[model samples]
Target: MIAVLFRWDIKAGSEQLFKEGWSEIVHLNIEKHGALGSRLFKSKDGEWISYSKWISEDHFYNARKSLDNTEQARIKMAQAIIRAYDPIVMIPVIDHLMATETTHINQLS
Candidate 1:
């Protein structure tokens, strides 16, 4: 699995619009392609971050291609929300032995 993290520092008073636009973009990605899923989060300091999980790097690249006519345009759109944005892709190394049983604990809760 691959995870893509997008960090945005939105301008003051533009949070709502930024979120609305980002939500639309996320919906379009999931609807048009088979993205695993995505989540949006906000920091205590007001920075917005988005994490999207994909089955493979190909899926991520393909979805991004389908979103805009050119790679530059897509990047420009992503950077529009903030003065500076950083995107990172990482592959996690999971250790099943150290993992907890979430299903059982959730049932009890």
Candidate 2:
């Protein structure tokens, strides 16, 4: 599998809009593009980030060539953001994540 990281710096008061758009896009990816799904995060500096997985780098690039049902969501996200960065590709050297009910950040404590 391959990992790709994405980041967006949003305009003030646009958090909900951004999230809604992101959710729409990601669901489409999982349903039609063979994505393994992604985890969303907010950086300490406030950028929105997502780490997504794909079966291969080719899958990621292929997925980007089409945006069949994500037009409105893409518009919302584009309007909400001040900046969007190019996706960062990564190679996996380890797999240490564990599955559990407490896997999320809020459940860590």
Candidate 3:
């Protein structure tokens, strides 16, 4: 499985707007493209994080391409949040159980 972690440091006053925009617009665009599904999270410090899963890199790329030509989509996306970073991290899962085990051990430790 391919996973993407997008971290956003939203503009100071735009947190709620960002979430609402994402829920209303971005989520649909993602689903339309090829997203398996995704979860949105907020840190204690107020940063936004999105974890998106895809079947393959090609699907992810295609979806992104589709989004680019969408002007209204881009406008909504822009209104939702300001990007703090470019090219969010993509992690290819190789051994899920091993990673889970390591996480559990780290939490215990």
Give one digit per residue, the lDDT tens place, for model 2 in 8-102: 89999998888888889888888888888788899899988999999888888888898788899999999999999999999899989775453
Model 2 lDDT, residue 100, Cα: 46
Ranking of predictions according to TM-score: 2, 1, 3
Question: How many pairs of residues collide in model 1?
Answer: 0
Predicted candidate 1: what Cα RMSD to the true structure?
7.0
The best candidate in terms of lDDT: 2
**Per-prediction TM-score:** 0.69, 0.88, 0.65
lDDT of each: 0.68, 0.87, 0.65
Off by over 4 Å in 2: 100-109
- What residue runs in model 1 are displaced by over 4 Å at the alpha carbon? 68-80, 95-109
Model 3 ranges off by over 4 Å? 29-31, 68-70, 89-109
The residue-by-residue lDDT of candidate 3 on 7-79, one tens digit each, is 8877777656665666554566565766766667789987788877777778777777774546565565577
lDDT, model 1, position 80: 52
Angstrom error at residue 63, model 1: 1.5
Query: For candidate 2, what is the lDDT?
Result: 0.87
Ranking by lDDT: 2, 1, 3
Q: Candidate 2, TM-score vs. the true structure? A: 0.88
